[model samples]
Target: MASERILSKVAEEQKKHALNVAMATTAAAEAAVAAAQAAAEVVRLTGAAESCQRFRKFDPNLAAIRIQSAYRGHLVSPS
Candidate 1:
């Protein structure tokens, strides 16, 4: 009868350990998912910034050409 009592106590401790392990695993998985989501957001924001920078690039030659074209047009037209 004492052995039966000891066996029951061992089984109870095993159940508690299993529950703790399951909880730890769940927390780790949630942290991993959050990290992945944060990484994806960084990638999205970086892509947007790069695209905007591309459009904002300057071209001095284009500016000069546009100014010259306007000046020629003005010189040839009646004042």
Candidate 2:
């Protein structure tokens, strides 16, 4: 009867350990997915910024002229 009780206690401990491991695995997976999503967003924003730089370089004088014209019309910088 003592051996049976010891076995039962070990089984309970094993179940608790298994549950803890499963929760940790799930949390790690969620973190990995979030990191991937953030990386993708960074890539997308980087591409957009690069595209704008290209446009600015394509016609520097034209962009400056447009900015001046807009400013004259009372369009202030949002910054």
Candidate 3:
């Protein structure tokens, strides 16, 4: 019957539309995951850089203290 054929065509079109929607959804999810990973890497690297900066600041003070203590000891010791 012509009506049955029309119904079948409509069903096929609906299926194709559904498939397109599903594909688009999958692509969007993949893009979001990639963006999140990139953001996390940026945060990690920033934290590591901050930690290195803190250590650099601490190192100079520690070195100065060690040098001063050694100089003091040399001055106090008898030749």
Task: Give the total clashing residue pairs for model 1.
Answer: 0
Q: Cα lDDT for residue 12, model 1? A: 100
1-79 per-residue lDDT for model 3 (tens digits):
9999999999999999999999999999976865665556556655655566766565645434544555555456664
Ranking, lDDT, top scorer first: 3, 2, 1
Against the true structure, what is each candidate's TM-score? 0.63, 0.65, 0.62
The 0-to-1 C-alpha lDDT of every candidate, in the order given, reads 0.66, 0.67, 0.68
Instruction: Give the runs in model 2 whose Cα sits over 4 Å from its true position.
Output: 54-79
Every model: Cα RMSD to truth: 21.6, 13.0, 20.9
lDDT: worst 10-residue window of model 2: 70-79
lDDT of 2 by residue, 16-48 (tens): 999999999999997686566555655665565
Which residues of candidate 3, in runs, are more than 4 Å off? 54-79
- Candidate 1 weakest lDDT stretch, 10 residues: 59-68
Candidate 1: give the clashing pairs.
Answer: none
The per-residue C-alpha lDDT of model 2 at residue 20 equals 100
Q: What shift in Å separates residue 10 of candidate 3 from its native position after superposition?
A: 0.6
**What does the lDDT read for residue 75 in candidate 1?**
52
